[model samples]
Target chain A: MTINSVPSSKVRVRIGHLYGDLLNLYADRGNILVLTRRCEWRNIAVEVVSIGVGDRIGSGEFDILFMGGGQDGDQQFLEDDLFRVKADGLRGAVHDGVPVLAVCGSYQLLGHYYDPGTGPRLAGLGIFDMHTVHPGLSVRRCIGDVVVDWIGAPVGGPSSVVGFENHGGRTYIGSGARAFGRVVSGNGNNGEDGTEGVVQANAIGTYLHGSLLPKNPHLADHLIGMALARQTGSAKLEPLDDHLEWQAHQTILDRRASHVAPVGGRVKGSGGSAR
Target chain B: MRSRRLRTGFAVAMGQIAGWVSRAVGRGGGTALPGLVVDYLDPSALAHLARQLPGGVVMVTGTNGKTTTSHLIRAMLEAAGWAPIHNASGSNLSRGVLATLLRHASFTGALRVPENAIGVFETDEAAVPRVLRDTRARVLVVTNLFRDQLDRYGEVNAIAQQWRDAISALPGSHDLRLVLNADDPTVSALDGGSATTIRFGIGDPDVGRDAPDHASDANFCPVCGGRMRYIRVTYGHLGDFVCDNGHARPTPAIVATDIQADGWEGTAFTLKTPRGERRVSLPVPGLYNVYNALAGVASSEALGCDLEPIASAIGTFRGAFGRFERFTIDGRRLVMVLAKNPVGMNEALRTVVGRGGSGHHVLVALNDFDADGRDVSWIWDADFEILVGQVSCLTISGHRADDLAVRLKYAGVIGSIPSSGTVTVLGGLADALDGAVSGAPVGGTVVAMVTYTAMLELRSLLVRRGHARAYWDDAGVNSPEVTAR
Candidate 1:
């Protein structure tokens, strides 16, 4: 239940994509837009921004942070910039409960270090107790439904079959760290079964893409509600209508419906993300 | 004698059964079984089933021109009166091809394969050595190489080198026949003295593509690692070429001559070879297609198919599935062109844009995937500079609409970028097509240059809408030869 405070305002979220750096996952931006749009419907002014290198990042200045996937070269080029900008204070801000949604490369960056090294070994800001290692290019393509057991606040519960995943980074949790969620059919965390994603405090990261928000807006609403809750110290959010998002979700259902199976009535292994 | 790959009444019979099953059990995936069947079947059992015929195997490969060129060669073989077992469905992978072979093997395991039928396969560029080692194809058609699938295949140069090493490493005992595209310096290197090689290309400088179409992948010599020199570039990086080093140079065993490309009217070229020059006019409308047809004819001849019928058949041949498939959408005659890579897209765009069809509507579907190559930076290289306000209406769709729109905006193209610039980054396939078609005035032609997966989606959508027919049903058993106009 989203508990809204009396003095609630529209929260805007911006995805600072260096345009073509990461954000390769089609589902990544959808997550952000869906998040903002859902918040707007909730009578909250959620302004999502496309921040870049020079953008400002101060504590208590924003509600949520998002970064998406990219190729190895993209990750390499942004290494120095991300290392300098997204470190320490910002990591701490995110750690102290500024809801951040990291997907793929960005998810790797949130870890202690990204190993098997894409180019140079990428060291994270130690925001999350995880180290992502490249398993030398295995086709870790995940299609069909992605179910996430939400570990964060507001939506602190189990959610099943969200979307798809295609990544090479084997996110192995460190000694003390725990998994974000379960993956029904993907190597979400170190090739474990039911690998959905991970959540530490207010931060949630996963490989599910295409702005996973619009198709699976429940997750988006959950994330936004959480972010707004963090910003206002209130878990309550006003109601909103989402026919367009429902239509988008219906599109996925229609596509899967065309390729339904006999045993489970599911369409498995059919997605366009070939990373 | 070769044995039949598809048993009699297998496809037709199985088609009914599958249809019934789909109706009964709802529906199922079209491509999932290829990999599943291959993974489940024993390798020896599969290999044994593959060789149940005397025709053996012949594989064709390259980055671009593989589909059109191989299809041409297959038709020519059949026209020259040869039974050829092929994966004409254009599923060019081990699993896909394996499933194709499964349809033909016999119940007794004694393959009733086509006696005169020769197994003509278009293998994936990276998967060639594996397919070759397995089938030991007697003849291999090596088309040009280019930069593609950077996320998976890596650099173009790396793939070319891998191709050379793979071909060269093959056992000398096998009569490894090779058909090389001399215009492409990277592929011509496969003609190393060890293998029996036959080079095919074009010589008509007048009708050749004015310059690089921007998406040319292979722009260097693979042998000496030196910059390659080009006498003429037909499209992208493909053209008549020679390396500064003596190691790689164009051979004149086969050449496309007397070329004539009438914008959208059609393209026709003469295949000039050691035997003689025979002009064939193809319905395909681009000089790039002339090279494809010539390569197909040349490859067919290398496999002992007569050049006369092959040439004649190509002259009358219609368009491939989507290279130039035409149909009526919203009462307008629209021509569809499949454009996956930058080179392919540029050539298709040039064909239409040159015809002053900018006044006409154009729809583009760009998908950046492992299938379409993750590194879509190549869009910067595509000659979309030609697309402009002259185009009355333009619609762009696919996975990365914003990315593609950004590329177009950067190109200063005055047409729709599918984002903000007079474009609609449609959320659905049907909506995109409807948006594109609806924007064009009645009777206005809509030309769509779509990527591979997009092509399939668009085709399926169009077919479902009753606006188009399955391509195989249109082309018939053997599409006519495209003769030089």
Candidate 2:
């Protein structure tokens, strides 16, 4: 599916947001805003279409795809629709190299299955060669500010991205999948392997979602470049002034570096300094 | 048993000493540390002291509006001539409740409040079960539950289950009165408990949004696990909904209707109750405050207070500390609203826009402090786009100043330099406050929307400038003499 390049004109791009209603728990819509705004700032016309349950995904209809995390109950309710209706289409798009970004719950759902320790095993779309386990109710969730040195860094692009991670499930990636990045701080993936997410082809899955993209413009641009490549056959993107974005990203990293250790734990209401 | 009493006495004495030292050292105002000390020494100290209150205890818990609603309830109780001990500093955990009790307790670990004294405490959402276990509150007001601090409280569903379990586990003899929000499906479903449940909701369908907010969490029915559809949505997930499994919104015993909002001046509504209808006006702005007032009225009535007195007391109640708190400096007005989560921030922006008309000067201070829920991503989920065409000057500050800048920029609030007026990004709270206030024209209003800790910092700055009083010294919610300023 090739798109003809029109020189010196606005190139309209369509972004497909899967389950925009149900699967947006952790401010995940910000990632979509980042993509659209970056495209708009560069004069690349953008339109976002929300494809919810009982909807069909036509081939080559989207330049990029996004799915976000959701509460467990909401995720459970949508599993049937996700697998029965959209699984084959989603797999087809990934096979076709349509760039996709899945964060947190959606990342877990891209794997083989998720065993929540108590409920019945939930099947995933098996797009990524990994599986997640909740361990149990007694185990603490991996939550705190997280930093990752992205393994698939583009030339002259940001190599490190910072975001927040909050999840109970421990994900283990198999040989079929490549580690998305090396965890520089806080708990990542299983909190034991020092791995953060999984990367397979043009698709990426991660738990780092302080919306994960606005502050990390490099990752946003990388995904945007890949998405645009499907149409223009060129991954070159003109840079915008990212002064505020980089400052925000660096602030989290600087805070982590200054602290003796990462600020974590169930900080009681009355205790703990605000900063 | 005698040794246990002696241990409690020793704990009280030591805890008081610790509190004195904490206050003397310029720490907190001895709000929660003493309770922590008492809890460490004797776990049963809270239960023992709570039982001594002749008027029993009332606990209010929710994701948002806990402090404001709790304050309103405390003021209503005070107006009813009951000496109420409340956690006025907004320290809402079990320790904070224990500290409030400890303040009115004797050195021998006995309550020293008057014979008509009552306990009115706000509790953190996750700490509800533990707080319920200790206090066995005669009345538990469950305000609307929204997703708050996922890093701390986990998921909303998990917290809802925890609350259901806690309420169901209450013994039949305690006779706990459950004040549930009928518009909130998650809260309305919390009626499985044996407590006498009184539900309150908004009845004006005109106020509901045509579409559900992106921050809504209760899409699935809390009862039969079926998908739910909303007929009307006020804000966020609070609305009239029915599930595929026939579960529907409960008929509220108390409902608000014919709402009239006068910008920041406040909202006046007709409150409908079984006893009779009363016209109530709240100094706090927004529909969220209406929900808060409904909760306060329901809880007060459950405690045997009459509707007329409750309505009147609510009208006389001033805003909570840093919640719609107004201050006059130079020649401009600075109204502060605390917005720590998406739903709360959405309401805050709505109130600010509603009050200041079209060309409003707004300041948003965001902090990733532990108390402020370290993740700042929720700002994107909030509907700051409402201020897109309504704002003339926008100022952002605090720990995540640039983060908020990015969010507002995307929301189109920080538009092209010439069209949207001006945008200021500062790292310091005081500088941002000055920038926002000065940016407004003379006689114009500047609304400050801040997080928990940032609000604290801003309030302290105001105090230093002799514009406001320290929260601890201000008799805001407790003193009947203090009316809406």
What are the lDDT figures for the candidates, one per model?
0.61, 0.85
lDDT of 2 by residue, A119-218 (tens): 7887889999999998775566677889999999986667998999888789999999999999999888899999989999899999999989999999
Candidate 1 chain B weakest lDDT stretch, 10 residues: B476-485
Q: What is the lDDT of residue B43 in candidate 1?
A: 44
Model 2, B428-466: lDDT tens per residue? Answer: 998889888888888878889999999999998999899
Superposed by TM-score, candidate 1 places the C-alpha of residue A100 at a distance from the truth, in angstroms, of 27
Off by over 4 Å in 2: A1-11, A118-121, A267-275, B193-195, B416-420, B475-485
Native-interface RMSD of candidate 2: 4.8
Write one digit per residue (lDDT tens) for candidate 1, span B1-485.
Answer: 12322332233234333333433552322222433343343444345555654667778888777777777876777787676666665667765456455445444444555467677777787778667776778888877776554445544555665666777787877677888887776677676654358887777777555455434444445665444566677766677666667554556588877777776668777777766777777887876777777777767767776668877888777656777888887687778888776667777877887786346577777775457764444555566767865565667678655445544543446333334335556645678888888787788788888888788778878877898765434433122222212
Best by TM-score: 2
Which pairs, if any, clash in model 2? Answer: A274-B369
Instruction: State candidate 2's DockQ.
Output: 0.47
Q: What share of the true interface contacts does each candidate keep?
A: 0.00, 0.61
Q: Model 2 misses residue B393 by how many Å?
A: 2.0
